[model samples]
Structure formats: C-alpha cells, structure tokens
Target chain A: MNVVIGIDIGGTKTKIGLVDEKGKCHIKTFFRTREFPDLDDYLDKIKSVSDELVENLDKKVTILGCGIGAPNASSKKGTIENASNLVWKGSVPILEKLKERMNIPMRIMNDASAAALGEMLFGGGKKMTDFIVITLGTGFGAGIVANGQLIDGYDGFAGELGHVDMTIGDGRLTGLGVRGGLEAYVSATGLKRTIMYMLSKYLVVSKFRGISYNDLHGEDITKAAEEGDIIAQRAFDYTAKMMAQALANFTAFTQPEAFILMGGLTNSGKWIMEPLESYFNEYLLEVYKGKVKLLESSMDGKTAAICGAAALIWENEKS
Target chain B: MNVVIGIDIGGTKTKIGLVDEKGKCHIKTFFRTREFPDLDDYLDKIKSVSDELVENLDKKVTILGCGIGAPNASSKKGTIENASNLVWKGSVPILEKLKERMNIPMRIMNDASAAALGEMLFGGGKKMTDFIVITLGTGFGAGIVANGQLIDGYDGFAGELGHVDMTIGDGRLTGLGVRGGLEAYVSATGLKRTIMYMLSKYLVVSKFRGISYNDLHGEDITKAAEEGDIIAQRAFDYTAKMMAQALANFTAFTQPEAFILMGGLTNSGKWIMEPLESYFNEYLLEVYKGKVKLLESSMDGKTAAICGAAALIWENEKS
Candidate 1:
C-alpha cells in the first residue's frame, strides 16, 4: 500500500499523480500554474491538491516520497533556477517548500533527465548501459546515461545538447542566443522555421506558404509531407541531417549503444526517422559505424513525464 | 615489496616499467616496436623486457599484475585492433598472448583513457569526480572521467574526442578520415598544417616560408611566434579558436570541473593559452561560463602513461 507523489510541472499546467513502484499512476490531479502567479498561492494550491489526493483515498496507504520534474531544475539545489518558461522567474526552492507542506521526502530534477532515468528503469533503455534520450519539443533537451547511471554533473547542468555550439543551420539563433545551435535546427520550433525558410527558397507550391511562423506544427508538416509536398519533405530532410550530425558527435562523447528520441518532433514519423537513421550512420566515425541505433520512445509524452517523475524516487531508493 | 608491470606501447618504441602501488617506476626498460614487424617477435621482446625488469631487481619483490596502454586497444577484447600507426595489420590479441606467455593477470586499455585514469589517481583531477583529459601530441585524443571513474564505453572506444565532427577549419582531414575534426586543428601536426595553409592563402611574409612540410614542428612555430612573426601568431590564434569551440561543446556534454591538457601543444605557452581561455569563455553556455577551468597536466607524458597503467590495476584491486 506504499505510494509516491509524482509531479510534472509545465509552464501553464502542473500534473500530479499518486504512483506505485511499478510506475502506475493510481490517481491524478492538476492545477493551472499561470493562474497562481503568487508564490504563496501556488504553493498553497500544490499542497491542497496533494493533500486532497491522499485524503480522498478509500483504502489505507502509506505515502513514501515525492518527485518533481520541471524546467531548469537542479537536483543539487532542489530548486528551479531561471526557468524562462515558468511563471516563477528566479530560483524557486520547490523541494524545501514542498517538504514543509508535506512531511514526505522529496527530490527534484530537470524534466529531461527524469525522463532518461524513467527510460533506464522501465523503457526501451532497460537493458542498455549507455544511451541518450532526446526530447524535441518547443526546445531540444537531452538526458545522457553513461556507465549505467544517470549523470547530472556540476549542479545538474550537464547534457544541455540543445545549446551546443553548432555549424549546420540557417543562421537562426537558439533560445540561448547560440547562432546555428543544434536546437535551432532540430526542435519543434526549428521544424516550423525550416518549413517557412524552405517555402521562401523553393519555387514549388506548398500548403505551408501562407501560415505564420508560430502557427505551423509538426503534425501539419507530417500530413503535408504524406500528401507529397516537396517543401515539407525537404524540411524534414534538412532537420534530420542536422540532428544526425549532432547525434554523430554525441556518439564520440559517450559512445552510447543507442539514441532514444521523444517529443512532438517524433510525430513527423518516417519523414524524420528514416533520414535520421541513414544520416546518422553516414556521419558516424568508422569505429562506431553500423553499431549505434536510433530508437523511438516507448512512452508517450504525458506518460513519460509522470512515470519518469515517479521512477526518480524508485531509482534512487532501490540503489 | 609488491609491484606491477606497466607497459606503454607506442608506434616506434615500447616502454616497460616496474611500478609500485604508489606510482613510482622502480625499474624501466624499452624495446623497438616498429623494429619488430612480426607480432611474435614483438611479443617476445615485450616478454624479455618485462622479465629483465623483474629479474634485475636488487631486492625481492612480488609481481602483482600487469597493465598496458596502447593505440587502438580494446580492454574488453584485450586486443590492438587495426592500429594504422603500428606494424601489426589486424587484431593482435596482446592480452591473450601475453597471458599465455607470462601467466600473470593483466588488463589493457587505450593510452588516452589510461592517461585520464592516471590523472584521476595522481594528478590535477584526483579530487574531481568529473573531468576530461586532452592529449594533443602528434594527434588529439581524450580521456573522459565521470562519477569519479574512467569511462570506456562498448569495447573501450568511448572517449575519441579527437574524431568528434567539427565545423571549423581550413579543409583539413583527420587520420581517421574525418574532415574538420577537432584533431585536424589542435595537434602538433595540426600546427604544421596550419602554417602551411596560412602561407599558401595569405600574402604575409614570415620565417616559415622555405621549410618543407615534413621538417616543421610545434617548437619552431613557438620560437617564431615568440620572435613576433605574424603568420606564426595567426596560426596559434586560429588553432586556439577551433580548440576553444570544441572545449565549449565538451563542457555541455560532461560538465566537468576542468579540462586537463597534456602533450606538445601546451608548450605553445601564452600564444595559445591566452586565446584559448578567452574563446572558451566566450563560446560557453551562460550557466557554465565561469565554472570550467583549463588546467595543465600535473604528470609529464611519460609518467602519465606508466603511472596510469599501474594505477589501472591498483584502482581495480583497491575497489
């Protein structure tokens, strides 16, 4: 009857779940993060939701610990620091404040890394010792696992693959101001940008021509590409090429057995995955050729966030 | 007394040292490697040198085990696989054959990774849990240490930073056939190549115009730059720029406390170091700007190889 609270905090919404050791969420609750911009109000809401979830349970159960996954979070500091996407601007000591409200032991980490640990414990990476989990959403994030353990070096800031200084790009800047960075070419935002750029460069007709920059999505591109749109096909090709280069370089760093990818960008399906595999092999060093594999995520986005959060507690507790 | 045999194999010569647990080389000997094209003869010479080091000892000593560091070596397979620099053509099972010849326990690893373990045990990285060691002699190599352990992923080929795909350069290719690789612009041979390329592209007059490509060395460039030669200074500046870009990318991957550099390129002094520091800081992500330091290798090249090899066995034995 033991359970842990897993919280996945987004910029707009926060999802909370009561999870068991096998990564199943028995019950779920949520609150709007933007609605409670005040720190006290936000903390109060989080406390109320957590308390209500435990209180409403019909059967007796033991609450073990709490795990939180959020943007710009540091496991060492137990806080989220300068998370641009979050309503809370500066460092928020979520772990300390949450522990004060609930007596359970709590741990916090960057969402990407939490997902990686989840993959390690329950996903396709269960049997692998060294691998990287890439999240290609509004931005690109990576969770690096080496020597069979999750690595969060120097205050949980390692494996920021999105911000890696890059050369293959259309001179667009990353959210961090790195020109031609990997994220500038591979993220969901990057896909929209690519389609826009390709439309301007090519003389061919396409469905994406009139759409504004932010209005375009990966799903639209996928549908158009399936219907035989050359511009859409070209965008996926270009994005895959840059991602392949980044993955190829990552191979030299960790020499991972495989690269497991997640996020909205994966929805592009065969358009990106096929080229990613081919280009990845082409760019790999001779020693690593025909060895490293590009894999799809076994968990969906929402399930990954919640399950990964829960796994963080179980992963540490078991070890 | 108790000791271990540390063998550091090179393309031209091989060094054999009888090292104690404290990392002191009690007795050292050597034999020509390129001189013995036959694998059997090379193995015999290595056996004789190791035997001589033990027999010639003035005091009674217990030989515990053996550790070897060599090019293209795989610790898992215990073989030197297709090393272009060595006379042996295919996979030479040095570990198996050496075990048959001597009957003592032995371990083998790549020289660069061995130097990293050497640093973790006896040099600047001793107190650090995460760091990278960069060897920039005739070519570039890297030893990555994370979670206070040396990492050699899947067949001992993980830390090949020299072969990381690069974006900056004057169209130079690495020995591994990688174009614009990090090694193409950061080693002794890199310096030579840079000077030649600059002389061809620029109209600047300098002291290096007449020298043949094979005759050039890092020392000559260091001397010329010290004497205020413009092209020499430019070569160092360009090399430092590319190297800094690489180190910045490495920081994002490992988030190491520092980068410890060894080999001939460090001798370039302020010419490279000053620019390297500035460029690295400028290129780093905002969170990691001031956190990573560039440190000189505390152990010399020869000491690093032997001591690191000895430390390999001692490290495993202690743990």
Candidate 2:
C-alpha cells in the first residue's frame, strides 16, 4: 500500500494526515499555524508532526510523496506568494524548505485547486473530464478543469470564479475590496452580508438579529437555517440566487459537466441547493438547460482538506 | 505544396477558397446559400464549387482535406444543429454529407470555434497556448482556448461568451432570447441598441437621431463616430464599456495572455478599441491587470473567414 502525507495549511491551523491512495485519512494531527513565527521552526514542526503520523500508521505502507495546499500558493514557482492571511511575508519557499526535511515527490498548489484535484481523483468528479470545483468559504475560489487538465493560465493564476463580476448595481464589496463581485454576494462572508441585509430589510424575529459582525460565523447561519429561521432561510435563498446567476454565466464560459460545491456554506444543504438548482436552470442558455448538474462535494467533513491536498501527489503520479 | 478547401457557410452566401498551408487564399468563389433550400442540393453545389477552385490553381498542390465553419455546427456529431439564423432546420449532417462528395478528411465546427482555430494556426494566437477569440458580429460568439486546447467542455457546447448574463436591469435581449447576455450589449445588433439608447438619452444633435432602428446599421454608426458625431462616439464608448466589463469577467475565468477580437464590431477601429483597452485595464482584477493584451485579429479582410475555416484542417493535421 502506498500512502502520502497530506497537509492543509490554513491561516490559524495547519493539519497533516497520513492519506492512503484511495484518499482516506488513516491518521491526522494539527498545529497552530501562527504558533511558530520563525520559518525554520515551522518547517521542523511540520516534519515532526508528519513523521509521527507515518510512524503511527498500523500497516507497513510505502510513503511515496507529500502534498500541501495553501492560500496564495504558486505551483509554478513552488512557493506561497504574498498570502494576505498568513503571518509569513513575501514569497515563502515552503515546498523547498519542506523538501529539505523530507525528500519526496511532493507538490503544492492553491487550496481551491487542491480541492478540485480531490474532486477529480476521489470525489464526485471521478471519471469526469471537465468540471469546476468551487470552495465557498471566506471567499468564493474555484479550480476549473477542462480537457482533464487544470487551467493554470499564463501566470498560473487562472480560475478566479469568485472575482468574476456578477454584480447588481448596489452589491457589497469583497475582501479583495472589489465591489459587485460574485464573492461579494456568494461566499461565507457574503452570506453574513446577506443575513445582515435581511436583518435590516425584514422585521422578522431571528436568533441572528443580535449577532455582531465579529460574532457571526457561517455555522451559526447554517444552524439557524436548519431550525427554519425565516431571516436565515431568506439569506440562504438570496445567496443561492446570486450563486445561480454566477453559475449560469460560468456555464456560458466552460459549460462543464458538473459544478461541485464545497466548504462552509454548503452545510446549509436544501436551503441553498434547491433554490440554486432552480435558478441555475432558469438562467441557463436554451441549449444548456437540463444538461449540466450541480453537485455538493462528497469530500466533506474535517478531513476533506487533507484528502484534497493529497490528491495533488496522486494526480502528478498519474501524469 | 499542400492546400485545403475552406468553406464559410453564412445565411445568405457561402464562400469557398483554396487555402494553402500558410492560410493564404489562392482563389475563392461564392454562391448564394439561400438559393438551394434543399440540403442535398446545397451539398452538391458546395462540392462542385470546391472542385472548380481546386482545379483553377495553376501550381501543383496536394489537397490535404476540407474544413467548414458554419452556424450551429457540431464537430463531435458531424452535424449543424438547428441554427436559428440558418435555413436548415433540425440537425443537418453537414460534414457527413460534404464528406460523401469529396471523401477527404473533412471537419465542421461552430464558426466562432473555427475562428479560434484560425487564431491558433495563423492569426494573432499563432504561438499562444491560451487565448479567447471573440467574434462580435450580429451576435457575440466566441471560441475559448485554454491549456493549449479548445475548451469544448463535456458536451462540446462550451465557449458561449455571448450568452453569458452580465445584465444590469433594462439591458436588451439577445437573439438567443436571453436578457443581460454579453451579446445583447457587445454585438453589431447590440451596438445599434446602444445607439438607440444614446439617441433617446442624449440631447446632442446627431445624424443617427433621425434614422429608424431598422434603417440604422453598424456601419452607419461607425461612419458617424469617425466623423466625430457625439451620439455615435458615445454609443461606441458605451459599447466598449460593456465589452470591457465582459472581457474582465472572462479574464477571471481563463486568464488568457490576450483577447483576439474578430468579426464586424472590431472594424470600429479606435472608436471602440481605445476605450475598450482603457476600461479593460481599469476593470481588470488586480492580479490580472496589465497582463492580458487586447489584440485585433490578424486575419482581416474578405479572405479572413476563408482563412478561419481552412485553419480547422491545418489544426487537425497538426494533431
């Protein structure tokens, strides 16, 4: 059996897992990403944690490679470039530093691209040649695949679906400071914005009405939605409408076989999916109607990111 | 020396050319497509005209294949699906019928896709692996190239840039019966719509203000703009703004090295291109700003369509 170490590097936490070839996590561990500010110490921490996971594996498996997925990662340069959320400044030679500690056929890519690779290799996109995997977290990031290849354009910065302008005149601004962008209306942050808008528009008594901007999280909205909170439900519906319109536009661009949704907001389930499907079908071009499908990522749960990261190694191995 | 028969099928006329390896047309001829309503007769007429053009060449040359770029074409199924503008109803087996007469390795695709192939093989996109060719004619059609391949998607119905909904409320509807589509605001028809809007809104005296919607054509607007007519200039500026926003959105999707403009709207020259370049730079995402170039298609002139059509053969031959 061949297994690879999968690392999911986030702003606050970094998780490493012993991932089998089939994308299942046998063992996993996490460390505070911000705890070690020094670059060399961070590398050492990652190596120790990864080594322990491999040693803890019950079966004697060959460690083939390691794959890491992070924000602002540049696969072409083998570095994470100016990630706004990370404490590390400038272009961090992460892959090089890690390779020094553990010499393996490792690879790194944008986190969203990693999720797309996961979807292709082990999730709903298996056997599918063309599709888009969207990560709807703090922002709307996507990895678009066509001809069974990732579209990492001229500078390796292709597939910025969230930033695709699907704006209504008075749409909110995104974290990137772009106004009227799709991410401004469809991301986790966008969902909160929707909830806030609804809270002001509708006079309905909702549990979220008292919540402050800093206090609100996507999970609270999902919980409220599951309980049939009117404002929360309406917020999800509004988000879905924005998402559907954007999906329709994206369909016109690539006309992918399926659109797989991932990350925090997808937990809303029927509240978003139902409205999204109907609106997407309603807005789709005449020829594309009843053709493309909208699917939620099968690679859900905490270990999903790890599986997605590990997929990078397996994908490269095949190529 | 080798050559290919290039056929550009249009609603009114069909042009046939003997295109050499370098995409230069040696000789060309045309026949009214509407004259022969019968599909069989149309195929016969095409084959006979093609034969004459091939024979007229004085120099000895090998006929490699035949390529046709028509509305509503399908390279996968070898048919022209119900093209709303074309006389043919339902799926007409264009390639199969044409193949029966010539018996050469023939292929047919959507005209826009053919133009994109032309770009890759002979035009502005000759050395580019990733680019999008926008054909702004009566409608906004496009052929998107990414990862060194045409993004024909799973259904081969991808790259519908015209149909992409970028609607602000009150945006005009396209021939596809879709509102807020890029075609509604960027095509030749769309330019007239812009002119009409400008006429109604602006009190500035202009020649086009007296013309009816039916009487006003894209050429009139271009001519008026060249003469420094305020309404005409404003219309071009408005069209460029809409087109720039659409292009910026498209950039977020594929992030190409350049956007090659083809078809009628590109002929407006500086009236549109100057403003388009300005707005494209202005509206482009920070990551993509100053990177993508807005290029006019090098395949210009009466022979342009023929070159675009012949490029299909050369593209396939390369593979």
Candidate 3:
C-alpha cells in the first residue's frame, strides 16, 4: 500500500493526515496555525509531525509524497500569495521549502480547489467529469472541475465564483471591496447580513428584530426558519435567489453536470436547497433545463480538508 | 499535402471550401442555404459542392475527412438540433448522413465552437491553450476552450455567453423570449436598439435624431460617433460598459488567457476595444489584474467560417 501526507492550512488551525489510495485517513493530527509566526517554524513543525506519524505506522507502506492545501495558494508556482487570513505576507515558497526538508515530491493548491479534487476522488462527484463545488464558510469559495481536470487557469486563480458580481447597482460590498459580489450575499456572513437588512426594512419581522448584528449567526437564522419564522424564511429565500442567479450564469459558461454545495450554510438543508433548485432551473436557458443536478458534499467537515489535500497528490500521481 | 472539406452552414448561405492542414483554403464556393427546405436536399447540395471543389484542386493532395460547422450543432450526437435560424425544423443527423455518402470520417459542432477551434488552430488563439471567442453578429455566440480542449459540456451547449442575463429588471427581450441577456446589449442589432433608445431619451442628439427606428443601422451609429455625435458616443460607451462588465464576470469564472472578439461589432475598433479593456480591468478582481488579455480575431470574416470548419477536422485528427 502507498500513502501520502495531507496538510490543510487554515486561518486558525492546520490539519495533517496520512491518507491512503482508497481515500481513507489512517492517522490525523492538528496544531494551532497562528503559533508559528515565521514560515520556517511552521515548515519545521509540519516536518517533525509528519515524521512521527510515519514512524508509528506498523504496515509496510511507501510514503509517496505530500500535498498541501492553503488559502490563496497557487498550484502553478507552489506558493501562498498574499493570503489575507494568514500571518504570512507576500508569496511564501511553501513547496520549495518543504522540498528542501524532504526528498519526496509535493504539490500545493488553493483550499477550494483541493476540496473539489476530494469531491471527485472520494465524495459526491466521483462519477461527474464536469462539476462545481462551492464552499460556504465564513467566506465563499469555489472549485471548478471540467473535462475530469481541474481548471488551474493561466495563473492558478480561476474558479473565483464568489467574486462574480451578481448585483446591478448599489449592492452590498464584499470584504474584497467589490460591491454586488456573490460572496457578499451567499456565504454565512452574507446570510446574516441579509437577515439584518430584512429586519431593518420589514415591519412584519418577528424574533430576529432585537438581535444585534454581531450576535446573530447562520445557524440562528436556520433554526428560526425551521420554526416557521417569516423573516428568517425570507432571508433564506433571498440567499437562495442570489445563489440561483449566480449558478444560472455559471451554467451558461461551464455547463457543468452538477453543482456540489459544501460547508456550513448547507446545514440549513431543504430551506436553501429547495429554492436554489427551483430558481436555478427557472433562470437557466431552455436547453440547460433539467440537465444539471444540485448536490451536497458528502465529506465530513472535520476531515474533508485533509482528504482533499491527499486527493490532490493522488490526482497528480494518477494524471 | 493533405486536405479536408470544410462546410459552414448558415441561415442564408452555405460556404464550402477545400482547406489544407496549414489552414489555407485552396478552393471555395457557396450556395443559398434556405433554397432547400428539406434535409436531404441540403445534404445533396453539400455533397456536389464538396465534390466539385475537390475535383478542381490543382495540387496532388490526400483528402482526410470532412468537418461541418452549423447552428445548434451537437458534437456528441453529430446532429444539429432545434436551430432556429435554419430551415430544418428538428435534429439533422449531419455527420451520419454525410458519412454514409462519402465513406470517410466526419465531425460537426456549433458554429461558434468551430470559430474557437479555428482561432486556436490558425488565428489569434493559436498560442493559447485557454481562451474564449465571442462572435458578435446579428445574434451573439461564444465558444470556450479550456486546457487546450473545447468545452462541449455534458449536453454540448457549454458556451452560451450570449444568453447570460445582464439586467436586474425589465430588459430587452431576446429572440429566445428571454430578457436582459448579454446578446440584448452587445450585438449589431443590440447596438442599433441602444442608439434608438438613446434618441428617445436624451433630447441633445445629432444625425440620428431624424432617423426612424427601422431605418437606423449599426453603421449609422458608428459613423455618427466618429463625427463627434454625443448620442452615438454614449451608445458606444453604454455597449462597451455592458460588454466589459459581462467579460469581467466571465473572467472570474474561466480566467481565460485572453478574450478574442470577432464579427461585425469589432469593426468599431478602438471605440469599442479601448473602453472594453478599461472596464474589463476595472471590474476584474485585484489578483486577476493585468492577467487576462483582450484581443481581436485576425481571420478574415468571409473566410473565417470555412477556416474554422476545416480546423475542427484538424483538431479532431490531432487529438
């Protein structure tokens, strides 16, 4: 059996796992990402941890290589470039530094792109050659797989569906300073903003009227909507409408076989999925109607990142 | 030398040519497309024209195969399905019918998709592995190439950039009965409509003031803009703005190496190109700044369709 080390670098914590070819994680561990302020320190910790995991394995397995997924990572350059959430500034030559420590091959890519590979290798997109995976966490991210290959684009910055402008004018501004961006209204933060905006406008609102902006979360809104709260229900509807329109536009471009929704917001389940499917079909062109399927990601959230990172290495090896 | 028969089927006329592997047309001819309402009649005409062209070739050459470009073509099924512009009503089994007669291999794809392949093989996109070609004719059409392959999608309707809805409210209706589509604002017909709408709204106008809606043409607006007509300039500006925004949205998705503009509208030159490039950059995300290039198709308009059709066969052979 052959195994690969998978590392997922998040804003707060970094996950490490030993993943086999069958998409199974044999061992997993984590460390606080912020603790290592310097890039060299972080790389050293990763190497030590990986060595310990490899030494403990009883089976005679060859460790092939390492795959790392991080925010704003570039697969073309093997660098993490100007990621806002991370303490590192400028482009970090992650692959080169890791290569200096280990004689094995390595690969790096954007976290979302890795997740998309994970979906294709081990999750809902196994049979789908062309599809999109959208991650709705604190911010919105997307991964596009076309013709059974990930589209790294010319600069490895493709699949920024979250930054696609959806509003006509005077729309909400995203953290990226762009107004009317899909992420401003489709992510967990976007859902909260919608509920707050609705409460301010509609007098028919109920329990969410008094809640402060900081205190409200996506789960709160989902809970309220589940209990038949009109305002909460409307917020979910609004989010779904925006998402559907964006998906419609995406369908025109790539015409993927399916769209896999992942991360926190998907927990709302039927409330978001139902309207999303309806509006997506309604807004889609006549030819594209009933052709694309909307799906949910099947990877467990806690381990999905690691699986995706491992899958990246497996995908490269197979290709 | 090796040659292939290339046929470009249009609503009004059908272009036939004998093209070499180097993207040069040796002999070419045409016939009215709508004259033969029946599929069999049209196929017969195509066979005769192709045979005549092949017979007249001066140099000794081996005929490889045949490639056809038509509206609503499906490469997967080798059929043209529900093409509104064509006289044929339903699906036409173009490849099969032609193959049965010629005893040679043949392929068929949408006209726009053929154009993209042509650009890739012999025109502006020869060096590009990933790019999009937008054809701004009476109706808008697009063909996308990703990772050196045309994205035919699951249903062969992958590149429908023209039908992407741009307006939030009541927008100009397309022939497909859809409103606010990109085609409604960027094509020649769309340009004339914009000029007419401007004349109706703004009191300060020029030569176009006296012209009725039916008599006005896209060239009239281009001529007036050249002579310092404010309304015409604004119309051009408006069209560029809408096209730029749409291109920006497309950039976020495919992140193509460049966007190649073809057809009648591009003749406006810098009047359209300058603003398009400016606004495309403006709307693009910071990471994508100065990354994507906007270009004009270098192929002659009259010969491009034939070149594209021929290139399709070459692309198939090479792959």
Query: Order of all candidates by lDDT, from best down to worst?
Result: 3, 2, 1
Best by DockQ: 3
Q: List the residue pairs that clash in candidate 3.
A: none
- In angstroms, the error of model 2 at A197 is 0.7
Q: Tens-digit lDDT track for model 1 on A122-177?
A: 78889999899998888898998888988788667778889887673236798778
| Model 1 lDDT on a 0 to 1 scale | 0.85
What are the per-residue Cα lDDT tens digits for candidate 2 across B1-319? Answer: 7998889998878999988878899999999999999999999999888878878878887889998888877777888877888888988988877777888888887888888988888888878988999988888888989988888777777788887887744566778788887888899989998988988898999998688999988888989988889999999999999899899888988889999998888888999999999988988988778889999888866887888889888887877
Candidate-wise lDDT, in order: 0.85, 0.86, 0.87
Clash-forming residue pairs, model 1: none
Instruction: Look at candidate 2 and tell me the lDDT of residue A50.
Output: 84
Per-residue lDDT over A1-319 for candidate 3, one digit per residue giving the tens place of the 0 to 100 score:
7999999999889999999987888888999999999999999999999998888777767888898989888889999988878999988999999998987989998999999999999898899888999999988888888888888877788887787777666688987888888899999999999998888878895789778889998888889998889999999999999899888888888789999989999999998999999988999888788999999888888888898999988987777
Report how closely model 2 matches the true complex, as a DockQ value.
Answer: 0.71
How far does residue B236 in candidate 3 sit from its true spot (Å)?
A: 0.9
Error of 3 at A235 (Å): 0.7
What are the DockQ scores of the candidates, in order?
0.64, 0.71, 0.72
Model 2: how far residue B220 lies from native, Å: 2.8
Compute fnat per model.
0.59, 0.71, 0.62
User: Candidate 1's residue-wise lDDT over B248-291, tens digit each?
Assistant: 98898878999999988998889999999999998988878789
Instruction: Identify the runs in model 3 with alpha carbons over 4 angstroms from their true place.
Output: A55-61
TM-score of chain B, candidate 1? 0.96
lDDT of 2 by residue, A146-242 (tens): 8888887777778877877776345677667667888888988899889889988999899987889789988888888888799999999899988
Query: Residue A5 CA error for candidate 3 (Å)?
Result: 1.3
